[model samples]
Target: RHYGIVYDNLVAAMRAELPKTVRFVAGRVSAVEAGPERQRVSIIGQPDVTARLLVLATGMGDILRRDVGIERRFVHQRQSLTFGFNVRPAGASAFKHPALTYYGERVSDGIDYLNFFPAGGVTRANLFVFREHTDPWVKALRDRPRETLIETLPGLLKTFGDFEVIDRVSSWLTDITVAENCKRDGVVLIGDAYQTSCPAAGTGVSRLLTDVERLCMVHVPQWMASPGMAAAKIAAFYDDPMKQAMDERGLELANFRRSLTIDTDLRWRARRQVHFSRRRILHEIDKFSPSFAARLRGLKRPQVEAVT
Candidate 1:
């Protein structure tokens, strides 16, 4: 019911499907000049190029964004850490489970969860944690990933069967940010350029896709049918109802994940208990009365509303 694919492979597949008329210039962008009717781009070792509009997808790169006078407001600094690596059964040829979500066993660990899923013919492990990037434990995990994982997650070996990390560990530190002063003539920001999401929140791609759909299908045609691409024209896309709701939901989910994992308040402590208890109950119910469990799952539960 769930699936995973390599990010680069997905991009390559999409690139291959693009129309022949679409051109991709390979060079570092050095400067940008945006205006009411035209946008100019200057790339290193390349001739200047101009277009009617610019859709920037430069993820977290601030040079061009700053060149155009856009600023970033950090919602949360060093919000979370994500680690990725390939894994395979140690002595056996297969694993006990196809996919697994292992929740952190201790609060002091600051680990949110470890996910194991099949992608690109290999079992990939993605670990999400709420911890300082400079922490000694983080260094230890990178230096001796297999040992550190087994020692920290003792049940992982038993739950998923013995496995060995087969590749270099890759780590990323995420900061939740949103662009400011982005409503400008001849330019628009989408995905991480407009806003960054917590990887644990699982909303980055959704937000990006939503932006593309609304901009391309809803706003672009309307804007092109008229005259100059002014700031007023760009503001409509930023103020789109669906896009605003999705962006707000991303922030809400990002905060909820952090609080659920690390907050030691009385309310969260009780909520945490209820959360795990419900999951355990559901697992047990499904094992015996799957049809009844399906009905219970079909019942709408309360949404995770944002708190001030």
Candidate 2:
């Protein structure tokens, strides 16, 4: 079963594990000046500081990246909409399942999927849809979330039990983008600052963490062992095989999710039917011939070449 945790709580726990030597200066960054040997940061109301290398994990906001002449190329515009809200069992003590994923039954609904999971000591509902912001359903959903959800997803109540939404609804519109012209001196972009992922694909954090691992654990020490921090040094992290694969896979999965949810073409329709059927078949097979089912699954899995 899937589980969830509050983001702030997770961050706090991570912060507690940090070394005391690490100091955090809280200030708005006004500008950045990057060079081969040093990187200068200008804070709105604080003294300027310089570092050997600059790493940006600031997310999709691109003002800082733009300051360094880095531009983001849109892979998909307004790729998907994600809605978040808290829910509680209407008349009961608890829900039927602690975690559940409900897929869209009809293609016309433009709904991808809805996830109900435990988070922040409450049942959290996250709905992903592929539709325009101007769509009437978007407004109706914001205005009357519980009723609209039940109406849009008829099987929701029967499957997950009755629920009532609490607190305000939060929504995010994602645009798939990748940073371009990022091979610069003394600076590197990570996470959403480098590329934005579709929430539906569930690869955003995977790619972000991969960026951190490859840069810090692998490349940073190698770069620091030398003298100058040139564009060539920064390019090594970008050119890392693991980072490239994760970034490329994120985009591929994003496209796959969109096409799977909305495409009405014969190929996709057939694929979708086969997709569901294959899962059911594998489940039944696993119950009987477990070893055979495992072998079948192994055969269907994609092969990857070693990145050494």
Candidate 3:
């Protein structure tokens, strides 16, 4: 929840609007049991709660999926690793811009990209690596984050300028996955509880949001009007065209980002060269004439900078 997302604040603000009938029981869920008539949820150190329908919005690591006959099949294990830290301009050098992005130079380097931006009163750096967690590089990062990163990415310091990692380097290893055998009675899994997204693809939140909108807004209301909480009704949500498309798109984008990052095929190699070359050209043009750069952007040619 503390992954620099605004969800905590949003929920905190919504606390005041909670109706008297809606009692918020805050505790960890230990077990879940679901049936056609009623669903029972067991919380640690608390009495069980029964509901007509059970919604599992827990992200990524919920064990309740198995209880509802949902399966998580990993499409790719150890897909990517991400590092989050704060950076500031070294000494009095002073950053000229509020944000900047630096792309990885080599596939062998195992670096995907690095994003440096201002958030929560600090310049936050999100770095994506396409290497195994057990790799020596990963170990080096854990032990000496700044030096290891600079070593792996030679041009990083020169491009982003010498900056210190002013906080603990938070890291995450992601597994690309999708839930199977999930269409069940009375229980529905949403967000990362249903499908896992590659952080490097930046589609995790998008997929989760699509899940929320479809399950909550589109399907649930219609189901409530009907008779039984059968698997058939639950399957309709998964069969929804929009939800299917978004899930497919998330998988597609995940593959695209991975290929773009480390695929050394001739075609991809050329595209990568052209991709950065075009940005360099535009950057030079921007330096020469800000107005001209803004005007040129009206052409709608995409200027993509990987934000990790």
Model 3 misplaced regions, further than 4 Å: 1-7, 10-21, 285-308
In model 1, the clashing pairs are: none
**Tens-place lDDT digits, model 3, residues 177-207:** 8899888889888777888888888877777
What is candidate 2's lDDT per residue for 62-122, written digit by digit as tens? 7989898999999999999999999999988999988988888889888889999998789
TM-score ranking from best to worst?
Answer: 1, 2, 3
- Across 23-124, the per-residue lDDT of candidate 1 in tens digits comes to 987789899999999999999999999998999999878889998899999999999999999999988889998899999988778888999999999999
Q: Estimate candidate 1's alpha-carbon lDDT, on a 0 to 1 scale.
A: 0.90
Give the winner by lDDT: 1 or 3. 1
- Cα displacement (angstroms), candidate 2, residue 254, comes to 0.2
Q: Where's the lowest-lDDT run of ten residues in candidate 3?
A: 299-308
Error of 3 at 43 (Å): 1.2
- Candidate 3 lDDT for residue 306: 34
Where does candidate 3 clash, by residue pair?
none
Worst 10 residues of 1 by lDDT: 299-308
